[model samples]
Target: MVDVYLFSGFLGSGKTSLLLNVISQIKESGRKPAVFMNEFGSLSIDSDAVENGVPLKEVLDGCICCTGSEQTEAQIQSLLEENKDIDVILIETTGAAHPVEALDAIYSPIFADQLNIRGIITVVDSKLWLDRSRLSPQIRALYMEQIRHAHLLLANKSDLLTESEMATVSMELANYNEAAPVVQTIGAKIAFSYIEKVLHSTKEKSDTSIISGKGLPLSSKLITFTESVSRDDFEEWVKSLPETVYRMKGYVPLEGSINPHLFQYAYGMVSWLPEYVKMTPRLVIIGEGIDSIKYE
Candidate 1:
């Protein structure tokens, strides 16, 4: 069975540069890799990036973040049909396509049973990553999910980081995922042997109970509520929260919980699937400023 590797990162994070390096390695190893790039609202800039003889199967449409599940599947299937013996696939997702959700869309029932979902790699731009504060936690959650689920992560653009800064980033990453290897590279120029060394473990079956629902077009607003009480009383109050909250999750220590508890409400839906850690739970309600709390 052929493998599919998804290489993604935020905008200007050297995804094309890294992909070129990997494709070159695949060529030298007497293997063929079909390349797919979904550059949202643009085209692939492969002039300086491609040096190898490997033919790239380019798809320069918008990011497959939401649509194109069937089209993306068809593109891959067509490649396989053209080259029935191709060794692997390398898909470079557009920066806007939250990498995990993009992968989920690909692995839907339509395509999930066909291809082996090999890996998802995210490259972080060290210089500007920390300053990205457009709903930092939400963005970071997506980034961290990519890192947490990856078999390998190449922290490309190492030149931007000092030795000390690299150490700090490494430490921070380790807190969440020490199992995956973190490689430092410049312009994603890591050696081929490093990538080929590990037989990437197969992806765990994705767990997204909420993804199947059609997300209503919501004009999201942020409202915050803070409370202080014993952990027991705090949790009791949390369970009784008005259902207008749409995805409120953060860590604020309550008076009694030994650890910080995180809570979330997906608008009208109620889910306690994610195990809650003990912490002060502050709720950020995302709903209309209007009184829409009666729906529940």
Candidate 2:
């Protein structure tokens, strides 16, 4: 059976950075690793940031916990078929995803005997969490859902908080999720040995039944445009996007540019960079109640 690792956390919680470190550790131990990335938006920002040479399968424009489940399952099947010798498959889910749904999607009857779930690692931002009380109830529910199903919770960015504050954060997380063990670190740096130990111990405690929830109504929209727009106009449009649109990403061609820029937006953050691979402009927006036609 192939070992599967699902990394879940809130947006901008350092999942990508920690994943890079984990992948490096796995490679040093002479294990072949494959990655499945879930992006809340359509653009492929985090996939590009991943170090070169790792085989990548991406599910874009939706969270794997909900709307993107079928595609994620298919991608996992494809990855296993293509990389017959891979030792482990690491799945990085969207920040807004629920681990319960993620587990459901990947736990297919066809792959029952072939796949073994290692554990779900949830990353937390100590700094941002200090103000979690002021966040909207919807966001707080999403955050709790991600952690409640974790096998290990990584309270990252501990350098930003004092020892007492760190303890408080850990205690709070424990209140929401008592099943998982909490490990605090700065910059999401964790020793590989500790991670392996956590995986083994969590597996010992896991039950045969999958976790279930009422389920969130997450949706996605993919839009393609044959025509290219000016860089200035594109930037302006991105800045004016609605908050209901949790994430948006895609490649966009400029009127006079040779290569199109890959754009990604999450929460209130927006970024655009020239993509190495040139492709037609295609935007994907994932969230609740998004009107794709309005953007077109």
Q: Give the winner by lDDT.
A: 2
lDDT of 2 at 93: 86
- Candidate 1, residue 16: the lDDT equals 87
Q: What is the lDDT, from 0 to 100, of the residue 156 in candidate 2? A: 95
The CA lDDT at 97 in model 1 is 72
Q: Write the per-residue lDDT of candidate 1 for residues 201-261, one digit (tens) a residue.
A: 2233222111111121111222223554455664565566555333433344546445544
lDDT of 2 by residue, 82-156 (tens): 888988888898888876567656655435446666668889988778888887999988887777667788999
Off by over 4 Å in 1: 46-53, 108-114, 130-141, 199-296
Cα RMSD for predicted model 1 = 14.8
What TM-score does prediction 2 earn?
Answer: 0.68
lDDT of 1 at 50: 59
